[model samples]
Target: MKLKSLFVVAFVVLAPATAAKAFPIVRIDAGQLIGRTLDGVDSFKGVPYAGSAAGPMRWRPPQAVRPWRLPRDAGEVGAMCVQPYSPGDPGVGPLPMSEDCLNLNVWTPSERTEPLPVMVWIHGGGYNNGSGTARLYDGANLSRRGVVLVTLNYRLGRLGFFDHPALAAERPEGEPAGNYGLMDMIAALEWVRDNIAAFGGDPEQVTIFGESAGGVAVTQLMVSPRARGLFSKAIVESGMGRQRGVTLAEAEGETLRSTRARGVAWAQDAGVAQTAAALRAAPAAKLLTPAPSIYGGDLVINDGIIVGHDVVTAFEAGEQAPVPLVIGTNSAEFWWIKPGDDTPYGRFDDDMTPEQIDALAQGFGGREGYDAHVISDVIFNEPARHLARMHAKAGLPTFLYRFDVVSEGSTEPHEGATHASERPYVFDNLYSVRWDYERDQRVAKLMAGYWTEFAKFGDPNGEGRLRWPDLRGEVDQLLEFTSDGPVIRAVPNPERLDLVERLYQKAVREGAVAPPAGEVGTPPQRP
Candidate 1:
């Protein structure tokens, strides 16, 4: 069905047209809201999108906001999903942690023409941390680009993603458990579909974009049946699709350990009953503890409900929602290597022999460079290319890119672009991140333009910018952002990607997921 049929946007203007000054009081699907306009942009912060995940709603799909008659305050951001907040975190304010974190923030150009394209940002903190209120994520600058910029928070950690036999048993027969974070994303999109018009947004032209774990979630949304028609375009930065996420149960797939097993074991340690009641009754803090586990942090669970199949599998089988897509990774995401483990060739051990592995190593600049690069290739880089090629082959417009820009105060000796170096520039919030370089502004504008351009039109190409090549007809090229400027170049290492793809396909056929970076085996100490 078309987006027009999907949303019935009826808002009661608090006052008749041409009022002296409206409090910007506009009614939405939920209720009347009052937002403030500043610096040519109107912003509504801490807007409730989903009902509380507290009480009986815990571990279940998000519900609607509890009804309210009065115009609740939309001035400040909502409490962050329960997480440890260090004082040094990005744009973090004094908002306390709570289970009632299903809120979103919207920014709109006060002087824009009617109905703008909406770009909903999903923040990335490895799925364990990050809220929509980070100072760097303030959407004013992007809103100035003539699109509604939305950033939201989803449940995180065990509270966000947990699967247990007991929980499954308690679920209505065939109802999906685990992956509540993904559910929260879908819920937010639904809010946008029905309510974004209140902020002058076009829900029909919505685009979902994210980095790292958020990027991964973007891919999951693309494959989720429930999320299919909610968005029209997608952008994934450093989101890994080739790797397998955990299966809800042993029989689910070949990803990591069954989520059900981990849940049972976690409950047993807490001396809590395996029943859903006992699990839900347990304090939320207990679930937030960070012990080493393969289940959390950018992990996906194939519950056959919310997320039907592996991301790559869905794209390959043509089951994914076909939308204009932009997917890529930074030059060097966080990865490590050690002797003996192939590092996974960092954690994905498979049938490739030493000779074959050596061939792969040479492509990435031989064994030493391979040690540094293979993990990234297997986990982030190659996976991006795989998805782009598949999506393009399906007769959809797909643009692939590599973020090679390095920010100030970067890792010593410059480890290419840090996993998330592009965010500051992507949002055109350089000063917020503490950089004074003039070159960055140009690059930032370029990157931001590419993104907003993609959101406005399904393609990123526009006037006064290098034409971004589409991955439709060819698979060997991509747009790479450099310190000097954005440039399109042949993919860095085709031979390496080829070898990794072959091995990945083999593993998929055999039913196995490569363990996450450092998920298994101790990495050799950083030199």
Candidate 2:
């Protein structure tokens, strides 16, 4: 495959007598790209990793970018994939929405003679609404610790994962239908494998990491034969893989008809003909007005090419990529669970009596904490533990964690460590809130140190640091990150995880719930 190249050229302006330091210039497969220096780190942004997915190219697998002659400017972020807008969505970068958003950014140490470990980040917004240029994902802080950090934008929503008979009929020979988003990720990894060395990155030592939906992508990629050998290590944060995937047969007409109908209806509503070409030509804004459901099963499917089987089954069969793993969730991952709403406790038949609520809460310590605990366990925590256990059972070195640090300005009385709260600390970018600056900084340093260390070495623990034992033996242990620092603790509520897993398995057996429908797994959304 012919891929794009990036040639970096750093432009310096100074007096004639003063010799200006040259910036880092690396030649990628596409072309040469010039990256700027920021805080002693060389940064490259808006570098195209694949061809534009606009107009005729939409919904198809990502194509290789046409080689460029001149070095394209790599100083600014590229456009984000078309996605619905949400109020206060911090993950959306300054760039506008476009179909041609298959670009990636890189951050590396300004000076490096030897190839360094690489960490590729996949942003999470429920598979429909995030960009790699999101300020929260700025790789400068992480790169300063001597690793190449990369973040890329992928297809989202219907554009990335829509299935229809017409679409299936149009698929090119040997190309899989659906999962364009995952195909984009695979393409980006292929680009990295062939080109990252020029930027002082060791492609052989790549670590793919992400949180939430991104975490789901990590697990999916791990189980994908197409994604095999693309990454050597994986980190999944709050990603649920217990759900089985719908096979292509299931997605064609069994479970995905409604999703395809939604796409067809949207196309008609937008005044476009119900055809792929017409849909591709439709305005991006029209597509964003009605946000796609995060729970829509079409996003990830067992398409035979990208995902041969459900992740759980693949892992159980030891068919997944054998890579070291670090996976976990926050303590209060599902604080969004509300009273009087359907919950994992088989749902309230009616407005539950206080006594009934209390009874339900008993397994989770009390009513005050019950909803968050149960929901978190079923949706995020337990699934993480299950995946960790699977990796350990397969003899792949596994490290697990539970993030429990409460941010300084949190107003939720019951919030301990909510979803995505650990991101800033992991990136060493604590600009989210101002509560305990010193403590937050310390947490950031500790977390970033652990992550960078993991990228460098398969193990997270290094000399003089807190000892983090790998998950082994009868008793499973997890490193808990708190404001007080890291502490070893037993995986909490093993019985709860077991119960959830059993319930999930029963559902699968009974066909009460369909598995993931595409290459990217979906985190179970609260009903």
Report the lDDT tens digits of candidate 1 across residue range 180-292. Answer: 88899999999999988878999899999998778888998988877979999999998877646655555343334656776777788878899889888888877766432
**Tens digit per residue, CA lDDT, model 2, 374-418:** 666766877788788888899888999999998776675675798
Error of 2 at 125 (Å): 0.2
Weakest lDDT window of 10 consecutive positions for candidate 2: 1-10
Candidate 1: pairs in clash: 91-135, 343-346, 344-347
User: Who wins the lDDT comparison?
Assistant: 1
Task: Please list the C-alpha lDDT of all candidates, in the order they appear.
Answer: 0.77, 0.76
